[model samples]
Target: MKKNVLLILLFFCLTDAFAQIDIKRTTKDNDLKLSALPYYNYGKGLGITSPDSIFQFNIRFRIQNRATYMQEEGEEAAIDGQVRRLRLRFDGYVGDPRFIYAIQLSFAPGDVGEIKEGENLNIIRDAVIFYRPNKHWNIGFGQTKLPGNRQRVNSSGGLQLTDRTINNAKFNIDRDFGFQVHNQNEHPDKFSYNFRTAITTGEGRNSTDKPDNGLAYTGKVELYPFGSFTKDGAFFEGDLKRETTPKLMVSGAYQYNNKARRTGGQLGDDLFEKKDMKTTFLDAMMKYNGWAAMAAYMKRSAHDPITFNPNDATDIKYIFTGSGFDYQLSYLFPSNYEIIGRFSTQKVNRDIAALAPDTKEYSIGVTKYVWEHAFKAQMEFTLDDMTYLDNTSKQNWYIRFQVEMGI
Candidate 1:
């Protein structure tokens, strides 16, 4: 109890000191606005661990309404409010200067309003602690903001032109259960750099499964020389990345388990090694104005040299590498809005769908924003292509739409 109080006080003190300092725009607006993100879980969280894992995907779309609007007994869908997210965040500081905070909560389908078993989920999305110690440097702790893929980093509030993509379920939480430290003068879109690292228990929310050792490590950096200095220049309000902007981003992760315990059928505890499991993720985003492209690779499991190959092996044992790449493209329309698509193929060694290496995925999606701001909506038509190491494959499809809001 005392520890919790101290934590609360510490958070306030940091924000207080930072908020005491002043800024121009902040001199005007003041107040904690309403926050409501009420998106629908059109589909479930799918992966190799997901039921019917043959090229699985999770889809989200939701309805929303404000308390002011709900008071009249009006439904969110009545206003044609297909808001994927309805969380109103108060983006400001305390009285005066050095602080800034965007305290947020979950109100989505899988978040709030869910009474179903196995579907219950609620979390502090972004109760981050930050300090603008100065202009060039800022520090904070709490769930860290995403800094890998561009489409991934674009806040949900501003994603009116684009619907939420199908990734988070198998990717990053967009939030981590840990602390963060960031350094940047401003929100540098192009040619900016980010360094994020966290020490989290591989267990996302297993509070009782406390450990003093197991931790997950993540690191990534993004640079868009054009995001800053474009043909229109950096200071220009509308200077979108019309020129050839080499948006290069790379990320990698490693997770280790200490005394980790997982149960498998017919497999004894001795047969299952507790060795720390490792996974690597890599992503790259690039664009030359109207033409944009991106790709990501995730390897949840890799072959261990000794167990992978045997000199006396009689049968041809096809060694597996884990989840493969997810690729995408962009076609800049006459309007600033861009059409997008994605392609993914994986050769997983384990699966609840059929057998190993039995899935391939191809997806096409589109999103367009009137301006460079995060305002966008997106939709995708995905074809789940499946395959078996023994020459087998399956095909399925899913359509998704997402309207996101964020500040």
Candidate 2:
């Protein structure tokens, strides 16, 4: 089944690429250049260049197909597979390079709304516009990924392994509708720095409106001692780009959501009622030669950890206040293959530790980068252990394989 899905996805990608029409036509006031290119800065897509540099657009899409096998302490091994992601993206600029816009649509079943009996494509991943006044400042508006954590912001297609750490699923702020400001200061002789801040509706992505009465405020700062990364490679795993010099970046972020409706901050389902929440993040990335390493820590808190309703026997679930950490290391070989290892641990508060088990996970994987991250095959084995407050323990092992095609 996985193979069939992969074959079908590949066929569609190829058909789309071959169906490209090359045209270089000029109008009275505008000249247009459109080409069907296999791989460029934006993957497999149509590239357009407008006359007089007034307007430009690129259309591209990608798909991720995966299969997995897992076994828990006393259960039979389970096998499962599905299409993980199917995304189509559009990006362009108008008049000046400073004015840029992007929109991404998701067709995957998991990414869209829950269908009663069938599937519905609830698209729209990123619909944002950016205005850069100068080299140091940029302003943006709309829905997009928040500057929450390194792993969360990194594109899934660019991961070194088959999947991200479990900590990200529980702690990272996925996306939201907001206004953002970015500032970067570069000094060839001194260390460079970058800063970001945002104000957004407390609700997560695709939320039509803010029913909660409060908003979310987020801020982040980063420092690079050995200058900056090549094409923002710090966000990606592995040393596939192979930096010549040793580069390092350290960052810290904080977010506060007043009257947040979701139990998992901005990523999970709505809670019984709103609660004020706060989260902190710290991360570091370093790469030298063919070796790369990353470490991150996350902690969450709420003003009211737990609440109850006197009217009914049921009460709002307690905020899963906790902490999580992840560490990753990888080495890239000249043959375009990478070996990676990851360790992650999560701990819940004492109040809910009995109900919510503490978790520890270890993963090792290898990736063959066909063309960087645009086209790759990856496989990994993971060992997950959970410890309950009663001292009981459960273990699970997972083996997974995935193919990523971004064109």
Candidate 3:
């Protein structure tokens, strides 16, 4: 089943590439980009633009491939790593730009878990209908990640944080399946806020329904009353084309999972829980010049139901705090170089501590602009430290170098 789904997705991607006609190109402008990342984690992206029509129509298609080389503890050599994610995405806006729709179907098979042979499956990453009323309000139907962390919102080029923080990956999937709404305040200084709530199966994107029984709720707000020089909808930071900003804020929120039970996937308890376990998160991100730093803490109770086993009979409590930071230092010589590092420590009272791995990493790299954007090269080295479900742990270092060309 998984193989068949994967085949169909690949076929559509290829067909789109060959068609290559921006059939309904928008007169407003034509912006087409194709970026492929073939690194230790191999991936590709393909996009198209059509001539605009009365409906103000546009179409885009993208496909991605992912593979990694992982080294296990007590192992001298590395082995084939998990195929983290295989995905196909379609995005388009309806007439007048009032309504839009998007769908992301994925095929991901891997993990340190038990894999029963002959079982391959695909899941919907984001199947949603989004609408924008005028310019201030945007609402969406379907599953999407809750806006809990600001950095996580920067998806494409937001943070240099080695990986996701403990608060994020543990609390949610970089995303979840649910309905969400957004709002922006343009005139009131550079102020903006987002309030979203959803009722989902809570199961990550890969699997379908189970027996758990409650709705999950999460919301976030941004108070950047001082708007930067951002044109249209593009981001603006300290300078042009920059999205992040230097602001002071007091942000807090909570997420609840109420289900009777759950079965498989990474978060067995993401969905289907009768008891409500609410995790409260509070933190702030501060930016100076091109560098930004962050610290966040969360406290969760034992009453939360696990998708695997739901029973009040077992109750325990846990509190965890994690801190991380990123640097945007610009080197005058030796091309343009940046240094980055992130680390998080976690301790849980009742949860399985073995599987709860704390992550720490350091990455330093440089990007060279050749022929004024005609070509570019990037080289980075990373060192990772992780303690696994087992008592012992392991760490590894890697050097990744790559180049890019665009016309």
lDDT of 1 by residue, 167-199 (tens): 322333244455555554223364565455555
- The number of the candidate with the highest TM-score is 2
State in Å the error of residue 191, model 1: 6.7
The reply for model 1, stretches above 4 Å from the true place, is 1-84, 111-123, 145-168, 171-174, 184-192, 205-212, 223-275, 302-321, 350-357, 368-379, 401-407
lDDT of 3 by residue, 96-141 (tens): 5678777766555532234445433535556788898877778888
Candidate 2: segments with Cα more than 4 A from true spot: 1-45, 116-122, 186-190, 307-312
TM-score against truth, every candidate: 0.58, 0.86, 0.62
Q: Sort all candidates by TM-score, best to worst.
A: 2, 3, 1
lDDT (Cα, tens digit) per residue for candidate 2, span 1-407: 99999999999998887677665676875866455433234335776765446777899888999999999999999998988899999988888889999899998886775754442235778999999989999899999989988998899988888778878877888788889999988654358999999999978877654475699999999999988887778778888778888889899999999888777766665577789989999999998889999999998887657656556656656677889999999999999889999999999877667568899999999999998888999999999999999899999998999999987
Report lDDT (Cα) of residue 142, candidate 3: 76
Model 2 per-residue lDDT at 297: 98
Using TM-score as the measure, name the better of candidate 2 and candidate 3: 2
